[model samples]
Target: MTTMDLHSMTGAYALHALPDDERAAFERHLAGCASCAQEVAEFAATAARLALASSAPARPEMRERVLHRIGTVRQVPPSAAPLERVRRGAARGRGAARWALAACVAAATAFGGTAVWQYERAQDARHDAARAERQAEQVAGVLAAPDARTRSVRVAGGAGTLVVSAGRDRAVFMASGMPEPPSGKVYQLWFDDGGTMRSAGLMDPGRSTQTVLMRGAVDGASGVGITVEPAGGSRRPTTAPIALLGMPA
Candidate 1:
C-alpha cells in the first residue's frame, strides 16, 4: 500500500484490526516513524484505561467482540527502514489527516466523549438484544401483513417513513438526520388514537437516525405524530408538533 494508505492503517494497527500482511507492513512503517509510534502509544494507553474502566460488571459479548475483532495478531517481523521515509514525508508536510483521526479518538477517550462511551452504549444495546429481537420480529410482522403499506414523510431536517399495518394495528417509524430538539427538550412520539393522542416514547438525544416500532396499540389511531417536550418527555404534547403524519385507513 502507499504511504498515505499505510498511515490510515495506524488506528487499525493500534486496535489490532489489521490482518497479518497489513500488520507486518505497518510495523515496518511504525519502526521508522517516531510520531506514529508515539501516537500508537497514546492509543494503547487510552484503550488500556478504558478497558480497565469497562472491566467491572463485564458482559460476555464484550469478550466475544474482542476475540472476534482481530483473531489475535502475530508479532511484526523486524524492520529497519522508517527513519528516511519519515523524514521525507515530514518535509513534504502531508498525511496529517490519519494522525488527526487517531488523536481525536484518543482525546475523546480522555474527555469521556465517545470511545468508551460508545462501547458502554454497545453494552446497553446488548442488554436490550432480546427485546430488540422481539421488536424486530414484530416489525417484520407489520411489514409482511397483507394490508401493510409504507408511506414517505417530510420533517424539517430529513425525510421520514412510516409503515402501517392496520390489519395488525401496528406501525413503524424510520428516519435519518432528524434535527435535535431545542436544549432541555426532547422529541416525543404519540399514537393519534382517533382524536386522542397516547404517549409512545422519547427519541434518544443526539440520535440522528433510527427505525423504531411505535409503542402501544395502533388500533383506532389516526396515525403518528412528533412533538418537542421536556427532556424527560411530557404526559401530553405541550408544544406544537414539529411534524404531523397521518395514517391511512
Candidate 2:
C-alpha cells in the first residue's frame, strides 16, 4: 500500500482488521510514524475496556454463528489428493488464512459494538443511581423534620406507616407484605388534597415491600392513599383505596 493509504490504516491495524500483508506493511509504517503509533495505543486501550462487562453470557446465537462459519471453511484433505493438488496445498492454506482474517474482523466489529452497548448501560445505571440517591435524600429530609410524625396504616393483607412533614411539604409511604395487584392491574399511590385525590405514582407490582416518596407538593395535602388500578394507572382514582393514613395536625 502507498504511504498515504498506510497512514489511514492505523485504526484498521489496531482492530486487527488488516490482512497479514497489510498488517506487516502498517507495522513498518508505524515504526516511523509517531502519530500512528500513539493512535494505535489509544485504540488498544479502548479495545481493552470493551471486555470489562463481558462477564455476562454471550447469546446462544453468537456461538452458533461462529460454529457455522468454521464449518464452512475449506481445509485441505490429509494426503488424499493427486501430486499436483498436493503441490497446491499452499494456495489452500492461504485461503484458510484469509477466512481466519475475516473471522477476526467480524470479532473486532462485534467487540466494538458490545463496548458501545456496555457504555450506554453503564450511563443508564449511573443516572438511575443518582436519581435514587436524590429521592433517598428527600425522604430523609422529611423524616428528619422537627414536626415529622408517623401514622399507622392497614390494608387487606399488609400494614404500613406514613411519615409526614408539613414543614418540608413532603411525606414518605412505606408498606410491608403488600399483595401483588390483580392481573392486568397495578397498585397506585395518591395524595389527598382536601377531598380530591391526586395521582402520586404507581407501585412495583412484583415487589411486596414498597418505599415511595409521595410525588408532587404535599403542601396542602392532608393524607395519602394506595389503591388498585389498571396497568399504566388512571389520572384519578377509579377504585376504593386499600389504605389511607391521615396527615398529623
Candidate 3:
C-alpha cells in the first residue's frame, strides 16, 4: 500500500475497528514494517485524546447500579504452588474459605469502578458514533499519508518528534511536538484557517513526543500551533503557541 493509504488506515487499526481484509493486510505489513508500527502507535494515542475530548452525557444513578452488579460477580483466586497450597490448606482450615471470600469481594469492588468507566465510555461512543467516525477517518488519513514521514525534533526537556504528512489531498501538520505544561494544564494543537484557529487535538503532560495527524485537508492552513490550556483543551486557543509550524498552500 502507498504511504497515504497506510496513513488513512492507521486510525481504524488503532481502534481495532478496521474491516477484516484491510486489518489483516495492515498487520501483515506491520509485522515487518517498523515505520508503520510507530505510525500506528502514535495515531492510536492521538485518537484516544480525541475520544477523551468528547464529553459524555451523564447517566443518572449509573454508578450505583454498576457497583451493585460488580459485588455479585465471581472472582478467581491466583494459582498457588502445590507445596504452598498444601501448607495454606493445613494452616487456614476453615479460615481459607473466609480469605477466599474476602479476596473475591475486594476484587469485585476494584473491578467494579473499572467496569463502570468502560460502560460510560461505551455510552459516550455510541452517542458520538457518526462524528467520531468522520473525525477518525480524517485523522487516520493523515497518519496513513503516502509520502508522509516523521522525524525526531530535539526539545529542551525530552524526546520530541514531528510527524508531517498529507491530508485532504494536501500538506498536513507542518510541525508537532509535546512540551511540558503548567499544573492542571495541557498543550493543545490548532489549525489556522484564515484568522480562526480550530482545535486539532490535545496533549498529555507526561508525553514527550507528539504525533499530529491533520483532519480534513491541510490545503489552506496558514500555520499549526501548540498552546497551554485547561484539560480537555479549548474551543479556541487560550495562549500563544509554544511551538508554531506553518505550511503555505
In order, the Cα lDDT scores of the candidates are 0.73, 0.77, 0.60
Number of the predicted model whose TM-score against the real structure is largest: 2
Instruction: Choose 1 or 3, whichever is better by TM-score.
Output: 1
- Cα error, candidate 2, residue 192 (Å): 1.8
Q: Which residue pairs does candidate 1 place in steric collision?
A: 32-82
Best by lDDT: 2
Count of residue pairs whose backbone atoms collide, per candidate: 1, 0, 12
Ranking by TM-score: 2, 1, 3
Which 10-residue window of candidate 1 scores lowest in summed lDDT? Answer: 118-127
Off by over 4 Å in 1: 1-127
Higher-scoring candidate on TM-score, 2 or 3:
2
What does candidate 2 score on TM? 0.57
Report the C-alpha lDDT of model 2 over 1-249, residue by residue, as the tens digit: 689998798667656677989978776666556566656666655774763344678899999999998999888766656766866887898999999988877876777775454334334434555577688889889888899989877876887888888878787888799888899899888998898999988888888898888787787887888889999999989999888878766
lDDT string, candidate 3, 140-192, tens digits: 66667775655443333444444555444533333334446778898777777
Judge candidate 2 against the unseen true structure and give its global Cα lDDT, from 0 to 1.
0.77
Better of 1 and 2 by TM-score: 2
Among residues 3 or more apart in sequence or in different chains, the pairs in candidate 2 whose N, CA or C atoms overlap within 3 Å are none
